[model samples]
Structure formats: C-alpha cells, structure tokens
Target: MLDLAHRGARLAKEHGSSAGPPVSLLDQEVIQVSSADVVGLPMRCVFALTAMGFLPQSAETISADELIRVRISPAWLRLDARFGSVYRHRGHAALVLR
Candidate 1:
C-alpha cells in the first residue's frame, strides 16, 4: 500500500492536492519492518491498500465515500495472489509484525 501512498504522494504533489502524501497515516504506526520485508513486498500492490488505510476519516467518522474517495492503484492491487490484514489501534504504536 505504501507504493500507492508514494504514488499518491507524488500525484498529490503533481496534481496539487491540498492533502499531503498522507503523513497523518504514515505517522500513525510504528513500523517494525526491515528493508528486506519492503523488498519482499510487491511495492505496487502493497501500497494500494496502504494508501487507503492512511487516509483521514472525515468529521472523525469513517465513511465509505471517505474510504473510497482515494482510489488504490489498480496495478498495485492486482499483482498479488495472497492477502494480509491491516491491523489497527493495537496496544502499541501501529506495526506490521511480520
């Protein structure tokens, strides 16, 4: 999903989105990943979900429009044959404990 985020960051950068590349979401979790894990991930697909996950809930409420407003990169979402869960609000700062 980060690939999407990076792309979105770039798109936002290029298209003049008032929203930044989504530092709000990026800063939410404490990442416990290695450069190796990042390498293992399909960068395009992984960051698609990541892009959505990091977006802000409008009026402090999560909604589908808010959820779907930001589209994940098609190339990123379609490349994988496997799946994983995006865990949120755990006891610690957010992390993907692979």
Candidate 2:
C-alpha cells in the first residue's frame, strides 16, 4: 500500500498536480490486495484515508452484495504525515508532507 502511495505521489509529481494521482489508481491497488482474509479492505482503506483527512469526509458509499464502494477524489492524496505510519516505511519519507 505504501508502494502504491509512493507511486501515486511520483505520478502526481510528474504530472505537476498537487492533488496527487487519481483515486481509481489507489482503488485498483486496494482491489489487487483483496482476499478472503482481507475482505472489504477497499472500504477500510477509504475509511482510513478519510479519517486522516487525505480523503474528504463527504464521500458517498454504495452497497452491492458484500462489498462497499466509494469514490476516491483526486484530492485524497495530499501525502500528509498525519495520514499515519504507513507512509513512513518503505523509503517513502520523501513523500510525506512536512
């Protein structure tokens, strides 16, 4: 997940967009990690990001079967350190916002 975040930050830097990479990218990353033991991880990722203010609190939730869907905004990747220790590992110290 931190790798994905770093990739997103790199992409944002390349594109010169302060908002970070598209939410779909992060969503795809989460989906890739989804498994029996990691069910609903995407929702949890969204919730965590939202809680950290990386994502907006007004995100809409959609329920389908056993899965919950949310639209991640472009502004959801501010790279703020307040987001948590996840960004601190994996050589991502440079990506964190001071």
Candidate 3:
C-alpha cells in the first residue's frame, strides 16, 4: 500500500522532464522508484525508521523483501538521481533495482 502510482505521478509533475530514469534498458522495465519520484520526506522517514529497528522485518515474503526494498529503494533513487551517469555504466535501472 505504498501508493507508488500517486508518488510517481507527483514526482514526474514536480521534476518535469528534466529528471528522467537514471538508467535505461534496451527492453526492460525499471522497478525501483527514483529519488525525484518518491515523496521525499516520507521516504526519508521510512528509511530512518527501518534503520533504527523500530520497523522490524520478518522472514516472510512481505516483511523480508518489501521492508528492505522500501528502505533502500529511496537510497537507490537518490543515488540514481545524483550519480546516474556512474551507475548507468554498471547496469540498467532494472538490474540495479532488482
């Protein structure tokens, strides 16, 4: 229920076309949210809270991956936004996100 669709739209509107996917693939879809695409403050708070152990992740599917994904996705987004050129050399956005 992270509501990424809304967040993505907002991000696109805010940044306009100046900010695009940091990495692009020839024929793949990127799964991670961009830093410029997420709701800034909320993602930061989620990352902090997850790091502090207040939001413990369980071994179940949802807890295991979603928790970590949500926590790190924003960081990846930030990295992509700031250092996209560097990452693009390593791999496409989909690979990095995965």
lDDT of 1: 0.37
- Candidate 2 local distance difference test against the native: 0.38
Ranking by lDDT: 2, 1, 3
**Candidate 3, superposed: residue stretches over 4 Å from native:** 1-41, 59-98
List model 3 lDDT by residue over 6-66, tens digit each: 3544554665566542222122322444444443223333333333444433324234243
> Residue 94 deviation, candidate 1, in Å?
31
Which residue ranges in model 1 land beyond 4 Å of their true spot? 17-98
Candidate 3, residue 83: CA error in Å?
34
Clashing pairs in 3: none
lDDT of 3 at 85: 15
Of 1 and 3, the candidate ahead on lDDT is 1
Q: Per-model C-alpha lDDT, please?
A: 0.37, 0.38, 0.33
Please provide TM-scores, in order, for all candidate models, with all chains considered together.
Answer: 0.21, 0.27, 0.21
Candidate 2 Cα outliers beyond 4 Å, as residue runs: 16-31, 34-98
Tens digit of per-residue lDDT, candidate 1, span 7-93:
545644664546544454344332233332231233333344554444342334444343222112312212221223333222345
Best candidate according to TM-score: 2
Q: Pick the candidate with the highest lDDT.
A: 2
